[model samples]
Target: MADQDTDPRLRWLKPLVIGLSVVFVALIMALIVGLITGVPQRRAEAAKQTAKPVPANLSPAFAEQVLNLPRNSRVADVFASGERIIVRVRLADGTERLFALHSQTLQPIGQLTIQVEK
Candidate 1:
């Protein structure tokens, strides 16, 4: 009643409503931009944070070559001790060589062989 169009007290209401609508739209746009930019960045940062694991079966060529041993041998059980891998190899001379392999490079740290008197 009393005709809202002619009401002088509500004169400033239209601009206030429009201003609030603009602020709401701006807040929504900011939120959308933050999500679009922040999500992938966080994901990429997380990906870079973790380290990758080495393959369990490394090629034998990476290991050290020894006397009378076959080429391209398979990497058997790798026993890790601090920074070394204890590699077991079957030599052609009918002897077992316990090769100490490096944990990082898979190289032979040392070799141990058992000898028996005939």
Candidate 2:
């Protein structure tokens, strides 16, 4: 008599447990897939932010400043990377000079002279 009373409850409990387990497994799989797909997208966004050049911080008067080079020097080539501009010059004495400047303000950052090793 008691066994017959509990039989209906057991019948409902088994299906309920199976349904809950399937839901739990589905949620876990979705979480794993989201993490796998989202990581590369986040890394690409971070790389784009870092690769962008920083804004120039200088007064308007600094913009008009001149970059002096040797007399008769001619610009051989120009290359730019990020916020820097590099000007390769052929000097009067047949040597090469590389001048690095800030791209936004055109302010001289530094210079490098290229000479053949003896």
lDDT winner:
2
lDDT of 1 by residue, 29-60 (tens): 99999999899999999988875665666544
lDDT scores for all predictions? 0.70, 0.87
lDDT of 2 by residue, 1-118 (tens): 6557786748778678999999999999999999999999999999998785544555446647787989999999999997799999999888999999987678899999998776
TM-score of each: 0.36, 0.49
Model 1: residues with Cα > 4 Å off, grouped in runs: 1-4, 50-118
Q: What TM-score does candidate 1 reach?
A: 0.36
C-alpha positional error of residue 86 in candidate 1 after TM-score superposition, expressed in Å? 28
Supply candidate 2's per-residue lDDT for 8. 73
Q: For candidate 2, report its TM-score.
A: 0.49
Alpha carbon lDDT at 22, candidate 1: 100
Worst 10 residues of 2 by lDDT: 52-61
What does the lDDT read for residue 115 in candidate 1?
A: 54
